[model samples]
Target: MDLKPYANYLRAGSAMIAGLAIGLLATVLSLNAGYGFNSLRAGPWTSWPHIGGADIDPYARAVISRSGEAPLGRDQGLAFIARTDSDGAPLDGACDYRIVDPLPAARYWTMTLASPDGRLVANPTERYGYSSVDILRKEGGAFDIDIAREARPGNWLSPGQAQRFVVMLRLYDTPLDIDSTPDPNSFPKIVKLGCA
Candidate 1:
């Protein structure tokens, strides 16, 4: 006979459930979307300099904790990732690509192919990436790295069977100015050659 009390309880319970659901969704999305705050973008490459520093934002800390990635310290260097080509196209393994270089000043650097989630893409060569010390260079110090399912002539990187991938570039002991905008021209360009 007293249905008003039951209805109020139901309404309160529904509101609490909805609030929880929305809150959880937001957290998940923010964490997965990217490292938070002060992202530096040059061409297709992006890096979160603050994420590697002691003053890192709360959201970035949370992301690093969840991802279990040991970010480079501020004094050590910076890490950048290119999920898209220089023309702003999402990197697809079906398409062949060439990374043309005029890399920023660094004591050392590395370029690697990884799945979007950061795992190395397995291939027949069993090569995940190349370091500055090992990458083949052209005359006068210029270089190009080719990415495809089939082999190319020089500086080849195979994406294997992965349908999608990202390029990770780490500059160790770099002299780059994090306080200012980096030159996009200095960073390498990912050019999509063609698709299968």
Candidate 2:
């Protein structure tokens, strides 16, 4: 007796549970997608320009939280990230690269090589990055850094066994508006050479 009402209630509860599960799965997948996190794009680089700031969106927050990466607010500075070369090819340790960076508007900046998971890639050189102060510049403040699986003459970053990697440029105590787009010529360029 009254089995019909009980069955109807069970059906509704199951449907609600299934909907919640599917929604949660989709949310997680979207957030973890490849560099698809909420960010601003400039040329080949992308950055969560407002990270660690009040302007950060929910997706950016989730990404920062999950990655455990501490970012500086606008007043502090900003970060620009590049995972591809000037030709839009993903950077590989098997290939050699030349990163030409002109004088950025920031007060101080550092270029570092990191694995996709954000950890510094290991190498015999034990060189992971070059800070503005340490870089050897040509006549002007512009400089070129070498990136490869092998050692280079100067300002070199060796990714070691890491098959793929990302280059991150962090500007600290900067006064420039990093969130805004700038002339492509103003930013650095990553050129890939032959791969081994």
- What would the TM-scores of all predictions be? 0.96, 0.86
Model 2 has a clash total of 0
> In terms of TM-score, how similar is model 2 to the real structure?
0.86
Best by lDDT: 1
In candidate 1, stretches whose alpha carbon ends up further than 4 angstroms from where it belongs are none
Candidate 1 lDDT by residue in tens digits, 48-148: 99898888998899999998999999899999999999999999999999999999999999999999999999999998899999998998989999999
RMSD of each: 1.0, 2.5
lDDT of 2 by residue, 1-196 (tens): 6698899899999999999999999878867764344566666777776676787777767877788877777777778889899889999889999998763587788889999878998888788899989998877556899887766786788889999999998878866555566566767899987888
* Colliding pairs, model 2: none
Q: Which has the greatest TM-score? A: 1
Q: For residue 10, give model 1's deviation from the true position in Å.
A: 2.1
- Model 1 steric clash pairs: none
